[model samples]
Target: MATQEEHPLIAEYRRFSPGSETLAERSTAVFPGGDTRSSAHYGPYPLVMDHGSGCHITDVDGHELLDFMNNFTSLIHGHAHPAVVAAVKEQASKGSAYAATSLNQIELAELIVERVPSIEQLRFTSSGTEGTLMAIRCARAATGRQKIMKMEGGYHGSYELAEVSLVPDPNERGSLDAPVSLPIDKSFPESVLRDTVICPYNEPERAEALIDTHAQDVAAVIVEPVLGSMGMLPASHEFLAALRRATERHGIVLIFDEVITLRLGDGGAQSVYGVIPDLTCMGKIIGGGLPVGGVGGKRELMQLFSPSQENPVMHASTFSGNALTMAAGKAAMEAYTGDEVKRINALGERLREGCNHAFQQAGIKGQALGMGSLTNLHIASNGVLHDARDSIAGMIAAGHIPRLLHLCMLRRGVASASRLMFCVSTAMGESEIEQAITALHESLAELGPYVASERPLLVA
Candidate 1:
């Protein structure tokens, strides 16, 4: 167990991040929990970042760390890439937002449509949240169905509809074959819960069965190719194929929420998997580290939004395709070619291998699981996890090990999500990968005795 001196997690957090402590305390007066994003918070506080350049972030305390967070995987090229900076600066001088369309927006859309084969046409929104919402609404409008089928523990966004059945309690999650649709919060209306059908992840037979059962009422089945918020769990090819077959057979729209997974490859996870959806929701890196979202698919489906006459689904955002974001996005996308994608993915593989080797060498039972350029560390003796329930159980059994390990990595000049998922960027090289591996070695050493004592199950 952690010694009495280290029992107070908050104290250790403050000792490592004193500046963040002060900043968090001050910010709490305005923002809830001293932070705006719920996913970014830590035990005591988060590092108050001043600025970032390339793959490094300098915090207010003058600590420079390799930025694996990458603004939640949005900055594929990392911070302040010269091309993106030039584009943003140039666009800023011209104008920021205008209700009218601009050439920059058209150019950006053209690039996206050209790269992603599924996207014959596209429309932009202000966020991934809005992108998923718009896709769901479009599906509903086209099919005239009400209910939506989402994977159990799949997170689309913050909205009530997208968040249905996100964090099911262990006891109430129901059988693996027949998952229950549980509300994420009380704010979700009973009708919303009723309108959602939860399917177990990576379970092809169960997914097909559930889709078949709910086919009459379900307008769409939305899923992340790689479950982002739930420990970077990648869906099996069989499961995704099953969804495609079932959705097609049932006349339901299949929507792949590639908001995070878009960074995986040239055509996104859909391209990698060779299974295209009826509608694709995208965000994150596509905007060049700015706020942007898009839904694209076959022209027949996407044309539902045609403003030529009465658009079926009403969609408009004041900043949907603002000039600045378009400029930056175009620059960023231009820089990211097939070669760049392969390089970053190779880096991610190296990171995973190094972390896994470290765990094995330390006689700790854990696994680094993910795909392409993203990876997540889960402390479990059960090997790689297939779904969110497995991830949640691993986290609960590991106690505070992952959290402490995260803090330990930060102190060692490495930064990742609090959950320990690290993403590789174009800015990172062999040196960054080695540094991350060394940090993992050091962090596991620091927490070794505690896991051996209190969490023997993790090391068993």
Candidate 2:
């Protein structure tokens, strides 16, 4: 009997990065799934990154790719920025971390508090997962409520509650008016599903009703202004405004998980939408490409974590405000001025427009969805995506075509998330944006035959 043949695209990818393929095999001896980080993993295998500088990275095979993924959007200034490098090095000479607060830590916090509209005070954590976890705990402690209201398909962090209904399986997700809380994996406990109230994304009325229904027990309503893992779907102002009104009327804490969306503006999505959240969970770029997280809010709500207060929320982490990360973060934030944000945001718009044109030129059904400096490609012709379900439908129809397109793009020297998510960084200029657009066009041309043969429905 003959063995099943590998897809031509996967075979091409394997050929293009044979060095990475060899390293991936070696990595499996120590790291599970041939990788330590699950989000960064892909098949036939992910590239073995040799080094990165500015907005470009070279794989072990000596192939250079424009770094659009930017380490899952954490490297806002791009890899090994001079300012960030200098700060990290300067701090390293002093010490990496300490048991006490560092000047950089205090300065970074002050900067965040001054910029973000919702964050009056904040406490750092080692990762975004911890940030959201502490935010939930803070709300529960403040409200004495047991339940948390999170949007369907909204991802806060790695925890059970934050990830409840993250994937939104169409079969089990129930009606849009009343989205049932379904776990992305089997690890979720029944109580977590019960404790989490799932509100449909972008449906203002439905979300308002859900909040009203669970007002008594709901401690907080946590949402992302632009749903990150859900194809970068931006929440409508009406939807976010509705949530704010509903949560306020119920006296429930309103938390904005701006972990990915913080780069959208000087004060994040809150300032852009003019919808103030009671609490905000942040990470990603704020850490200056290091591990970090933070939960901040109105002084009254944030005071819960104050050690000076009675029975404080018990916030403590070994590396929360370590000197090295703080120095790097401070330098990153300082370099990421308001003008740089605007410039990168314009590049994002240009990329999206160019991508949409490429899909049309290739006669493939697809579009780019996102806000400001963040963007995601979906294999759908849908005009405006309001929620995850809309994006998922396209993913289902395209089958393996999107993955094929990703591999093709990589061969063309552009790197994005395996899911086709792209982001613009300060290090990227108009030229880099154009380079990625050209790569996308070429990749789409390569995949046109596959779409027409295997996924005809995706043909424009």
Candidate 3:
């Protein structure tokens, strides 16, 4: 048994992080919970970041730590890369937003269209949320269908339609054969819920059956190739193939929500699986650490957005394709190449391997799961998980251990998502990966006894 003061769990989190705590208090006066994003929050408080350079972020508390959150996987090249910084600085003087089109927007779009095979035409939006919204609307318009299909645990954005059936209770989620659409929040209208058909992830036969059953009314089937919010669960190639075949047979627009997963590779997750969707919703890395989103697809489907076309789907955003974000995105994308993507993805694999080793050494039932440059830590020893239900169960069983582990890592000069999902950046190298591994080892050792004692359920 460890002494109270000597316990690594309690001892490691005692450092003064006043800058973050103080700023959090001040922010609470205006923003709920002193933060805008619920995913970024952690117990005791999150670090108030002052600035970031390369893979390091300096918190207002003056503590320097390696950043793995990467602004929720938006900073593909890491903070303020020379190219992006120079572009933004140069473009800021030229003008940020203009009612008219700009050359930078055209260049960025051309780059994306050239890289993503399925996207022959594309349009920019202010956020991934908007990009998804537009994709759904376009699907509806193109097919004249009202219903949509989405994975039970897949998250697209904040809209009611996109968020439907996101967090279904096990009791209400129906069986694996036929899933039920469970509302994520009460704010969702009954009509929206009724229009969404929920399908299980990684279950190809079940998904195909569901899509076939609803083919006539379903306009689109939106999925994240790698489910980001649900611990980065990658969809099986068979599952995605089933979707492609079913949607093609039924004339349903298949949408890939790569908003977060776009950073995975040069061609994105689509390239990895060799399965292409009719429409791809993208954001994050494309913005170069700025706010931006996009929806792109085959020229035929994208032509529905043409202003010159009669009764085109209406879409507009004051900040969409703003010159500043466009310039930064162009610079960032230019800096990233196929080789760079492969290198960063290799680093992510290293991080995951190190984390798995740490869990084994600590005699804990935890595992790191993810693909390419994105990864997440699951506090379970149950091998691999296929869906969100398994992820939630692992988290629930861990009690406060996961949160405590996050705090411990922060104090040890490392930062990952509060939920323990992390992504590698181009700015990070082997040294940073090793630092994260060392921190994980220390945090696990710190929390080991408690997990073995109080959270006995977590022990394998």
| Top lDDT prediction, candidate number | 2
Give the TM-score comparing model 2 with the true structure, all chains together.
0.98
Model 2, 1-460: lDDT tens digits are 1125988888888889888988988999899988999889988789999999999999999998899999899999889999999999999999998989888899999999999998889999999999999999999999999999998878888789988988887898899988888988889999999999999889999999989988999999999999899889999999999999999999999999998989999999899999999999999999999999899999998999988998999888999988988999999999999999889999999999999888889888999989998999999555777888887777788788888888999999999999999999999999999998999888888888888888888888
lDDT of each: 0.88, 0.91, 0.88
RMSD in order of candidates: 2.0, 1.4, 2.7
Model 3, residue pairs in steric clash:
365-380
How do the residues 1-460 of candidate 3 rate in per-residue lDDT, one tens digit apiece? 1246554554445455765666777888888887888767776667788999999999887889999999999999889899999999999999899978999999999999889878999999999999999999999999999998988888888888877766677778888888888887778788888999888898899899999889999999999999788788899999999999999999999999999888777878998899999999999899999999999999999999999999999998899999999999999998889999999999999999999999888888899999989999988654779887777667667768888788888888998998888999999999999999999999888787788777887776
- The alpha-carbon lDDT assigned to residue 430 of candidate 3 equals 97
> Which run of 10 residues does model 3 get worst, by summed lDDT?
1-10
Q: What lDDT score is found at residue 432 in candidate 1?
A: 98
Clashing pairs in 2: none
The lDDT, on a scale of 0 to 1, for candidate 3 is: 0.88
Stretches of model 3 off by over 4 angstroms after superposition: 1-14
What's model 1's TM-score? 0.97
Model 1 ranges with Cα > 4 A deviation: 1-10
Model 1, 34-128: lDDT tens digits are: 88989888765789999999999999999999999998899999999999999999989998988778888898899889888689899988899
